[model samples]
Target: MTSARRGGRPRSFRSARRVRHRLAADLALLLVAVAFAVPLGWLALASFNEHAGLRTSLPHPFTLGNFQAVLTPDTTYTPMFNSLLLCGSATALTVAAATLAAYPLSRYRSRFNRPFLLTILFATCLPITAIMVPVYGLFVQVNLIDTLWGTALFLATAQLPFAIWLMRNFMDGVPTVLEEAAWTDGASSMQALWRVVLPLMGPGVGVVTVFTFIAMWGNFFVPFMLLLSPDQLPASVSIYTFFGSYGTVVYGQLAAFSVLYSAPVVVLYVAIARRLGGGFALGGAVKG
Candidate 1:
């Protein structure tokens, strides 16, 4: 018994060392998470406190006036609605166009595909800022400035390179044989793509839609340049209105509006997470 107890000491010490290392790693991660979360937490707390500034504090006596002030017709309502309309349209257009574009890329085996894909990769890496001056000139020539639909269309087009790249990868994981069976049933290529391929790609579709919506929603520059009307602004630009011309600012209201502005993206993320309950087994997607 004495000999066995002594032998167990080394194993116990090793286990203790592992636990200590794991605890340290966990503490480091916790600190990192808190660092990221602190500003967001502060915003939420300040949103509820009428007297709150940019600095975080526990709300001494919480009030909903900041939110109420922002939500009134003169400030947040029009911009928030415009953002929803513009972002939703852009997301729908981008997803539909990307689906069509990805189908051919995923289905065909062509020599041109690699070069075309490389072109798209290069386009994806191109900074939007670099092309904005040219885009603005093009918009002026076409008389598309101040038009919501035009702006949404441009947003969709701007995001196409990335969206098509992501969608094609998702489409490639789906088995070719499924579409072949649909083709055998006398379905046209587009019909097969629509009826067969898209049904199985619900999660992928959700991901693309969420991504496009968030991108458009958060984009300040595109709309800022193209949209001339104050009524057509999105929350991203409208948030700047809280900063007064004389350098005075409405910190509490800004925080409240920020919370509201970020809600849609958060909701979309949660919905997508729930919709994608588990990763699809691409093993079953293709058989060796």
Candidate 2:
């Protein structure tokens, strides 16, 4: 340290270098933010603009027709209802299964857990496209095709591996001393989990629930493959009809449809954000 100081690089000079590096990082992040925000900004702008096709221009008439166009019975309302039911059911199932599965995995010490966790991590990365063929065949044999509930179940299962992984981490973070007290009070594991652990882990549960709902809400291919009937289709699949293979698209109506279709997911995110406001903290669960 003395030798370095003798080399004439003072502490103030090093601090100045650090400040410059931080400023450079801030500038780089600002550029990246702009890159991401541009498309979203355009979408919002175009949604209000009449006839805003592929070419971008200010809304001459500045009409609300796009919103009006997409809010019809068949285009928005029915499909939105279907999406809510499907996504809500799937998120509930995923959280329940994850909570139960995580409890055992978090509490138990076993030689198999590391490998099981690795397998789950691997499964999380598996693309839906790669697994669809066997999934389709299995559904056909089990009579699950064309059923909305069946589709929701599959979506829940597909989201399970990651959910289990996340829930396990949350469960592990909760101090075992709390559970010990519950056990001392003659409470069963389930009772302790319900009364103690869950109440404390609200933020984590909210995170998993919101993410699972969003994933299922925006899922297009799974429902399209499973739900054969027109009326049964969710908004994600229904929205595709607005675009064309030959570049003949309804840009104005499509933008409106996209915004309307996206509202539920946004609302869900906002609600969850409020729930997770202070972040996940175990607080005074353990008395030092």
Candidate 3:
């Protein structure tokens, strides 16, 4: 009877302790969630409120004027177009170059491979700000400053080292036998990569593309510094226009523009969410 009592007491204590721990964790998570949700809630509510301030509250009298005010050609349309053009081109360039650069590193074992990869990894850690001054000078000398294509090229180069590392890791997951088989059937190295390896690693490509696009899309400093003409400014830089010179801000319009600016990235993620979740699709590919 005494031993049973002792065991029961310990078990009860453990159960109570577990319950307390779980409750604490749940409360912490809720607090974290609320922290993020508050800003988003404010953004949504304030966009429709004419008298929006730095608070989250429902619009007493909702209006579409905020969206209407920001939908003009110069304010929204041209900047959106420029963002799409610049980011889209840069993403394509980054993905293509990363893939080609990663292929040999992933496939062949070379004495220099580890050193090269380490160098690339080190490059990713270097902040863009550190190199921007030299980059700006180089751009000026080449007369590429203020050019969208030039900015896109710089964006691609900036993103490449990380992209190459990511691509190599993904490429490693693909079986070399697939490439070997393609080569046996008269396919060249590039042909095998294009036809066999790339098709298999669709998720990797999608991830890289989305990552590069989103990064460049949200980037303000590089574009602002490189492009002199307001006509060439992306939505990221154009967002500053909502800030008045005398410390006033068009809060409702700013919130509305923020929603629109974020839409494309959300849409892109939704479009590829299924494929990314599907993963490598490599099951049974190497089966005997």
Candidate 4:
């Protein structure tokens, strides 16, 4: 009876301890989540407030004037449009270029392959800021500066190494037997790639698309340096223009514009989140 009572007490103690640990962990996670969410919540609330109201410490009445100000013709829609255009074109180019480059890397194994792959990986590791001056000078000499095409070309090239690496990793997971069978059935190399390999690469393709879009969309420094004209600037540069070197910052407008700017990205992630997980997993699997 004493042994049974002893066992019961110990078991109860452990159970209580476990419950306390779980409760502590849950509380920690909840606190962390709240910490992360507060800024976003504040930003959202600030976006709807008036410029005068934004300076206050407490919650104030909301207005759409900030968003209205952002939407006005004199503000920055043209730059936003330019950014969208450049980013879209750059993403398409990256996808095409990466796909082509990846196939060769995945399918062929020559003595030069390792060195070439290493070179790409090395390029990916280097900061673009390191080469910014030289790239800008080359663009100026070629008279490509301030052009959307030029910006797109630069963005595409910068993203190429990472994109190729990602695509090659994805392609490595694909069975070569499928391509061989296609070849046996009189399918050309292009046909096999298009009909067989590509369909299986949907996840990797989606991952690449997301990466390219986000990178190009958010890039500020390159666009700021290359694009002198306001009309040619991207959304990121336009956001900077909202701030002045003097006093009295337009916090309301800035917040409103930021919220609006983030909408597309939020929508994109919401739309692709389901696919992103699988795609990322497959891409990583290929690498493994």
Candidate 5:
């Protein structure tokens, strides 16, 4: 009886301590989330503020005037449309190219394969600024300046190396026997890839889509240098037009435009989060 009583008290005490520790961790995480969310909340609030209220430290007299200005037919709509088109096209091209390139790299073994994979990995590590001058000159010679197709092509190529590397890693997790079995059943390589491999890679594809879209949408430097016409500009460059070297910054319009620009990415992230859960489950099944 004495031993039982002693052991029971310690176990209960440990349980209580663990509960307290878990509660503390939860609270800490909640605080961190709040801290991160505050800036985004402020930005959202500022987007609704009137132009006169924008300069004030505290938000007062909230109005939709900023959004009205931002969404006005004559404002930055054309650039926003261009940005969406460019990002969508670039992401599609990147995924298609990467999927084709990654399959061979993941499945094959040869001396040349190692060097080729290494080259792609090395390219991913290289800074974009290092090649900008040369790329810009080449684009100029090709007469690709100030065109949406040109920007999409550039972004797709820039994103391709990283996309290939990531897709290769993802493909490695899939079993070769699955493809082999399909081939034994008289499926061609293309058929095996389309039916067996791609369905398993849904998670990687979602990840690639989200990442490529964000990168292409937010890229400012490339568009700024390549696009000379306002109508050809993307949202990233058009947003900067609200502020100039010597002119007064239109903080209200800028904030509103930023909120609008970020909406699509936020929605995509949420959608991808749902797909990611399923992706992990599928990936595990493929691996097992």
Candidate 6:
């Protein structure tokens, strides 16, 4: 009877402790969800509230004027176009460069590979602000300042190290044996990369593309510092126009623009959502 009581007491105590831990975790997650949800809720509410201030509340009359006001070419269309152009071009360049760079690192063994990868990792950690001064001077020397293509090129360069790192890791998941099979079938290295490895690693490529595009899309400081012309500025920089000359801000319009500004990213994610979840799809490619 004494042994039975002792064992029962310990088991009950452990069960209670586990319940408490689970409750605490649930509470923490709820708090985090609320923290994120509140701002989004505010943004949705304020976008329709014409006289909306910083407060989160329903629109008194629920207006569509804010969206109408920002829908004009100068306010929304042109800047969005610029953002698409710059980010799209830059993303393409970054993905291509990363694929090429990562291929060698993923495939070949070299004494310098680890050191080179470490250097790339270190480069990814660099704050763009730290290098802008020198980069600005170099751009000026090369006559690239205020140029859209120039800005896109720099954005691609800035995103390359991280993209390369991600691509190499993804590339590692693809079996080298697949590439060897291609070689046995009389394919060149490039052909094997294109026809064999890339097809197998579709999800990885999509991930890298989405990541690079999103990073470049939201990057304000780089474009603001490099591109001087107002006409050439992306939506990221142009969004600042919502601020009034004084300390006042058009909150409703700002919220509306913010919603619109975020749309492309949402759309991009949706477009690739299937592929991102597709995994490697390499299950039956090889046989024992």
- Candidate 3: regions farther than 4 A off: 1-12, 244-247, 269-288
Model 2 stretches astray by more than 4 angstroms: 1-27, 244-248, 270-288
Among all windows of ten consecutive residues in candidate 5, which has the lowest summed lDDT?
Answer: 279-288
* Candidate 3 lDDT over residue span 1-288, tens digit each: 999877777777889999999999999999999998998998999899987888777985799989999999999999999999999999999999999999999999999999999998777777787678888999999999999999999999988888888788889989999899999999989999999999999988887788778778888778988988989999999898888574888888899999999998888878867765766542221111
Model 6: runs farther than 4 Å from truth? Answer: 1-6, 10-17, 244-248, 267-288
User: lDDT (CA) for every model shown?
Assistant: 0.84, 0.83, 0.87, 0.81, 0.79, 0.88
Question: How many residue pairs clash (N, CA or C atoms closer than 3 angstroms) in each of the candidate models, in the order given?
Answer: 0, 0, 0, 0, 0, 0
**Candidate 1 residues 1-288, lDDT tens each?**
999887877887889999999999999999999999998899989999878987899876899998899998768889899999998899898999999989999999899899998988777777787787888899899999889998999888888888888788889888989889999999999999989999998888777778778777888888988888878888888777888574878888889899989998888878777554586321211110
Q: Model 2, 188-279: lDDT tens per residue?
A: 98998899999989888887888778778888888988887878889989887786465787787888888888887899888877655676
Clashes of 5: 0
TM-score (all chains, Cα) for each model: 0.89, 0.84, 0.88, 0.86, 0.81, 0.87
Task: State in Å the error of residue 157, model 5.
Answer: 1.2
Please state the error at residue 8 of candidate 3 in Å: 6.6
Candidate 4 wrongly placed segments (more than 4 Å) = 1-10, 52-59, 245-247, 275-288
User: Which prediction has more favorable lDDT, 2 or 3?
Assistant: 3
TM-score of 2: 0.84
Deviation from truth (RMSD, Å), model 3: 6.1
Q: Which is the winner by TM-score between candidate 5 and candidate 6?
A: 6
Q: Provide the lDDT at 140 for model 2.
A: 93
Model 4: how far residue 137 lies from native, Å: 1.8
Better of 2 and 6 by lDDT: 6
lDDT of 4 by residue, 86-192 (tens): 99999999999999888878998789889999998877777887788998999999999999899899999988888998899889989999899999999988888
What TM-score should be assigned to candidate 3?
A: 0.88
> Please, what are the lDDT tens digits per residue for candidate 6 over residues 1-288?
999877777777889999999999999999999999999999999999989989999997799999999999998999999999999999999999999899889999999899999998777877777888898999999999999999999999988888888899899988898789889999988898899989999988988899789878888889988998888989999988777465788999999999999988888878877765656443211111
